[model samples]
Every structure is written in C-alpha cells, then in structure tokens.
Target: MKKMFKLQWLSVLMLAFVLVGCGAKEDTNKETVSKEDQQVEKTSYKVKDDRGVEVEFNAVPKTIVSLQPSNTEILFALGVGDKIVGATEFDTYPEEAKKIERVSSSTTFDSERILALKPDVVIAYTTGGDDENLNALKVLEDAGIKVFAIKSATSFDDVYGDIQQVASVMGIEDKGEKLNEDIKAKIAEVQAKVKDVKAKNVYLEISPKPDIYTTGSGTFQQEILNAANVKNVFADLKSWPKVSEEDVIAKNPEVILTTVNYTENPAAEILARDGWNSITAIQNKAVYFIDPDISNRPGPRIGEAVELIAKAVYPELFK
Candidate 1:
C-alpha cells in the first residue's frame, strides 16, 4: 500500500511539471507574436507641401530645420521645440527659438551648412526661394534631406491650419487638433461680434517712403482685411502692387493700415504725404497702426491681428 501511494505521488508530480512547462512555452510564444505585430503595425505618412514637394519621415521627425521665423514660432507652439536643430535669423519671438543654430540668414537658406548638421527635416517658404537666393531645397533633396515647404499664409484659417498641418507632419496630430480648435473658437468669437457691420474700403500701406506698396487681391494681408469685413482699396491690384499718393487720393480710402515697425508712425506719416491728406481716411482721422510682428507674420498670431484690425477699423462693432 505504501509503495502504491509513492507511485501515485510521483505521477502527480510529473503531470504538474508538464503543465508548468506548457504554460511557460505558451507565454513565450505570445510575447514573440506581440513583438512581431508591433513591428508590422508601425506606419507613417508623407505630406506634399505647396511647392509640390514630397517629404517623408519615420512618423515623428527627431531633428528639424526651420527656414522661417513664422514656422519656428509654429513649431515651438506645437511643443516640438526640442526637435528643431536649426533656425533662421530674426526667429526671436517666444525668446527661446533664438537659441537654436542660425542656419539661414535674412530669409536666405544655406543648404551646405544645413546638410552638415544632418537634420531630419527642413521647413521653408516658397517666397523665400526668390531670385536673390537660390532655392536651397534641391541640394538638400539630392543629399537625401527632407524638405517641408510651408505655404504663405493669407487668411485667418491659413494661419491656424498651417500650425496644425505642421504638427501633423511632425506626428503630433493631437496637439495640432487642439491648437486648430482653439484658434477657430477665438476667430469665431471675434467674427461673431463684427458680422453684419458695414464694410469700409481700406488701403493697407507697406511703407510711406520713396515708394509705397499696398496689399492687393492675391496677397495674404488682403485676406486678413477681408476677414475683418474691410474692403481693400487696392483689391483690384494683383499681388502687392505699388501705388502712388495720387492713387490713394483717387481711391478715397475710408481707412489706412500699415506695419507698426516703421521708424515713423504710418498713419501720421501718410497723413503728411503730399496728396494723402486729401484722402477720406486722413480727413476722418481713421488711419491706424498695427504691430508688424503680429500683422505681417503668417503664423499663429493672425487671430490677434484680426481683432486688432477689427477694433481699429470698427470700434463700435466690438461694443
């Protein structure tokens, strides 16, 4: 009987050992399968920018080169400040972006210098690729660098949308969505107060010096004016056309808008111009100064620009 009991105990021990081994094998298989699945499921998307450019990355780029100050501001806002390996001159706003390597000088890009840094992505403007500066993009592409061409922002939506768009390209889609919603709400609130108000013809002056440039039909500044329900006097002029004082007098502009960065106040200087005093905007003292940093930069601050203009152009509408 004792011998029989020992045999039964040994058999039970063997069965228990077999079960434990099978369970361990099954767990190991599951872990291996999980790792394989993760490898297969990982994916990323390529975005085609304004210049008909295609750029690819590993879902989220670890290093970036910002070619424009506006783009730099957008990247910082998107919480990807650490990703930026280099930035352009005058990327001073927000204070922190200034610390990055200055790869571009005065809106001009240097591909050779940039390529040496081994950045994962490059963000630039089509306008920055003008006659004075060769589009440094081709060299970077030939060297296997990723270039993300940011389009010139015109309207309020473009400002907000581009922020989200860049975030998406950088694989921070959630942050982009939140940013877009916030700007949209802010814009809608501003628009709600200004809607149904009578529109005025506005002449947006770039400068009041030897030559004057004004925002026209195709310019982004014109879109901002339209958003505020102000009719641009040079709306018929194509793409930031030059105008004379006589033109302003003939147009009979009800309002004048210009960059605030000028040495002299644009409103006061324009009123002092030879023929500009005859303009209705001057006669009514409707000329106003707007901060060029906010007004001109085609970035996230455009909503603030709209509000600034709305208040200056139609103070009664806000109240």
Candidate 2:
C-alpha cells in the first residue's frame, strides 16, 4: 500500500511543471502536493541548499516563507505549498499564490513581516550575490530564522535539483523524484519533435531596443533553442550581455523572440526596429514573443518554453 501511494505521487510530481528562479526572479502554479503528504516523520534531516547553506530540519517546516517565485513554484510542485505562510509580492502562478501573504519584492525584503509570520523556514535566492541578497540573508539568519538560499540557477536540471532540495526539506522525497521524472519526460517530448528538423538561427531578447539584453551560453534560452532545434545567434556571447543592433543584423537570425511586453504589439515593435528589416527574421516575419515567465522562471513550465519555441521556429513540426 505504501509503495502504491509512493508510485502515484511520484507520477504527480512530473505532471506539475511549477519551477521558480527568485533573482531578478523578480518573477506560477499547479496541483498541490496534497494535505495527506504533509505529515512528516519525527526525524532529523540535514541538507545543503544550492548556495551551500546547510539546513537542518528537526521536523517538517510548518510555516515556510518563499522569498521568490521560483522557490514558491518548486514548493507547490513538491506538494508542500500549503505550508507556505509567506511569499514575495511577485509570486503568482497557481492563482492561490495571490491569496498568500505578500512579504518581499525584487528590491527590498520586509524582514518585519517575515518575522511576524514566524516561518519555520525562509527560502531565498541570491542573484550573483549582490549586496541586497547578502544583507537579506544575513538579516534573517541573525534573527534566528532558518533561511536557506537557493543559488541563481542557469538551466532546467538546476531547477529539478532545487525541487528535490525543497521537497527533501519538507520530507517528501517520493513526490520530488516523481516530479523530476515528469519534467524529464516533457523535455524528451520536446526534443523528439525537433530531432529531425533543421535548426533555425534564433535571437532572444529579454528587454527591447536600446538596452537589448541577449543570453549566450549557460542560459536557459540557449537550452530551449537547442531542444527546439534552433540555434541562438548570440551563443558566442556569455551571460546576459547588451548587444548592438549592427551585430544582430550580422548574425542574420531566421527567428527573433522577445519577452518584452511593455508595448501594445510585441511582434510589431520588433518588426519596426530601424535597421532590422534587412535581417532574415524581419524579412520572413518570424519575430515572435515568448512569455518571459515560461522561458526565464526556471521551473516546471520549462517544457512549455521548448514547445512554444518549437512551434514558433518550426510551425510545421507542431502542426
């Protein structure tokens, strides 16, 4: 009987694609882990978070505080979101997130509100170890809060590891294993679709013109493009670098994808770039928008990012 429930929940973990990255993380939802799984064995558990923040859990965390959306997504997917007593203002995916107490933001964290909640654990993110991130961790740790810092993630596998970390802390390893299996299955499905397709040259823009920031190697967008059988034009660059329009024209990308959503028409705005009409993407009208949330969130919806790119770069394959 125990084996059967374990198998069932393992499958449940896969079906839920709610992963989160809490840095600019400045960042969703899915089925919960269920109340029945909330019961934890009264045993000591110790593990290190991504940042090497060693955490010891004497018992399951009863009141968890998520400082970013990615941690929030991971917790929910592990079937332990109900334990969340506080989340950042940016946490929104499963709709139920909106109803939770808003406790932090991209620029500032309200230590007072967090302390008020008396969370058993506070999961946070360190985006390249900025001053704010360091201070936030210090403030909470100094206050006797068991804060665990999840390092800034760069790929999908990291997200999976993160889910396991959170689930382990919550004492739900079966659900975590199942969730990893599910995510891998979805990724395989995405890859299968693009296996034989010819790769297209792609350029991903997180922000619009003037300060166009594009990802190079070691970024999630590059992986999505790779999975979708598309090549990134800026793969030669490292990290998120500000790119010049002249270089983009030289790259001759066949498809242009942007996460920028400020303008009324995202595609049209890309099409209107002054010197970009000569680019292959503009000439063929292939400029498209991918929800920044899906591509950049570092959670379960990563498979959705691959699917969307596959369809955009090679519509025929999906059709």
Candidate 3:
C-alpha cells in the first residue's frame, strides 16, 4: 500500500512540471509574436521639407547629421539620440549631445568630415544655412545622402511643425505629437498665471548700447514677450532691427530685457548707459538679463523660455 501511494505522488509531480513547461512556452511564443508585429508595423513614405526638397525612406534611419542646434535638440527629444552621429558645436542640450561628433557650427560645415561619418540623413536650416558653403549639402545629396531643410520659424506654431518634421523623418510622429501637446500645455499654464496682469512695454536689447539690436514683430523672441503679456517696444518694426538710443528713449520702455551675453554683466552695463537717467527702465532699475539659449534657441525648451521671461516681467505673479 505504501509503494502505491509513492507512485501516485510521482505522477502528480510529473503533471505539475508539464503544466509549468507549457506556461513557459506560451510566454516565449508571445514575445516572438510581439517582435514580429513590431517589425511588420514599420512603413515608408516620401517627405518634403521647408526647402521643397523631397526624400524617400525605405525604413527608419540608422545614422543622422544635424547641422542646426534646434533640429538637433528635436532629434534627441524624440528618442533618436542613439542615431545622431554628428551635430554642431552649439548643440549643447540633453548632455548626450556633447558626445557626438561636431560637423558644423555658426557658419561652418565640413563636407569631408560629414562624408567620413556617412550619415543617412542630414538636417540643415535656411536661417543658418544661407551661406556660400551651404551648397555642400548638394554634394552630400549627390552621394545619395538625404538632406532636409528646417524652416525659419517666426512663431511658436512654426516650432511645433519643426519638431513634427524631424519626428516624421525618424518614423516617430506619435512622439512628436505628444511632445507638442506637452509644450502647448506648458505655454497655456504660463499664460494663465499672468493673463490678468497688466502688460508692460519692454525693450529687448540683443546687443550693447550705441549699436543696439532688438527683435521686432516677426521673430521668436517677440512671440515669447507677447505671450508673457509684455509689449515689445519694437513691435512696429520687423526682424532684428537696430534701434537708436534716441528712439528708445522716446518710446520709454518700462522693462529692459537683454539676451546679450557677450559682456560679463549686461544689466549693470545698461544701468551705466550715457544720458539715460530719466528713462523709466534705467530709473526704476528694471533691467534684467535672459540666457540667450532660452530665448534664441528655438526648440523643445521654448516653453521654459516663455515662463522665464514671464517671471522676469512679473515676479510677483510667478512667485
């Protein structure tokens, strides 16, 4: 009777082992199917950029070269940092960007260096690429490398489109959509915080006194100032207009904001401007400095820039 009981116990153990083995096989099969589905989901199509250049893709790119810092920022934001083989010297965000090879910066692009990298796609922009050497992009195109020109954005909506363009080329439009929504949400949050406050006339000094340069209506800096409920004293002007001290004094801006970092202390320098004792901004000590990257670099951090400007304009509301 004892021997029969032992045999029954062994049979139960064998059945349990078989059930566990079947469960493990089921999980393995599910993983294989998931991978197969992912492979099957990828599709290819034609895309045209701001420059009217079209490129066809067979699949997602393996390597990329970004000449524009804003475009580079967008590429990394969309989870394509691993694919970026080269970027400009100014591409300093996400911390991982500094690890990539520098192929372009300011007004320079190295064709030989870019050729050595053999990137599948290259991102350039009209505002930054409008130079004699920019034709080097054609040399890369002749060699079967795809080139896409990012648009010269004058407003925040244009920036959203820029992100979508990069995301689509990388086959990640959903990520772009999600990112733009987040940006829009953050902008709306800043707007709500300062919506009821009185708008202040602001003078945006992009350069030092004497040869002072400032942004006007059709620029990203002006859009941010407007969102913060601050009026640009140069709104009637267009592009980066050079303003005379006489005209600025006549307009009499309440707040003086500078993005110029070439000097050690921009606000202090503003305070020491010649013949400005009666001006409201200098008199009330409303001179503030903004980081050029936050205001000038058009990318995913624009909402942060807008918020920073808003705080500078109305610290009481933000605080």
Which candidate leads in lDDT?
3
Q: Flag regions of model 2 displaced more than 4 Å.
A: 1-40, 128-132
* Candidate 3, 1-319: lDDT as tens digits: 1110011111221111110000000001111112431321234555677656666666667899987677777888787787899987777887999998987645457777777888888876653334333465677787778887665666787788888787767666668889999999999999999999889999988877668888788777888998888999999999778889888888899999988777889999988988887889999999999987777777888899899899988989976
The C-alpha lDDT values of all candidates are: 0.66, 0.72, 0.73
Better of 1 and 2 by TM-score: 2
Tell me, what's the RMSD of every candidate?
Answer: 21.9, 10.1, 20.2
TM-scores for the candidates: 0.77, 0.85, 0.84
Candidate achieving higher lDDT, 1 or 2: 2
| Candidate 3: stretches off by over 4 Å | 1-43, 127-134
Please give the TM-score that candidate 2 achieves against the real structure: 0.85
Model 3: per-residue Cα lDDT at residue 33: 16
List, in order, the clash count of every candidate structure.
Answer: 0, 11, 0
In model 2, state the lDDT of residue 268.
Answer: 91
Clashes of 2: 11
Best by TM-score: 2
Error of 1 at 137 (Å): 1.9
How many angstroms is residue 19 displaced in model 1 relative to the true structure, after the best TM-score fit?
69
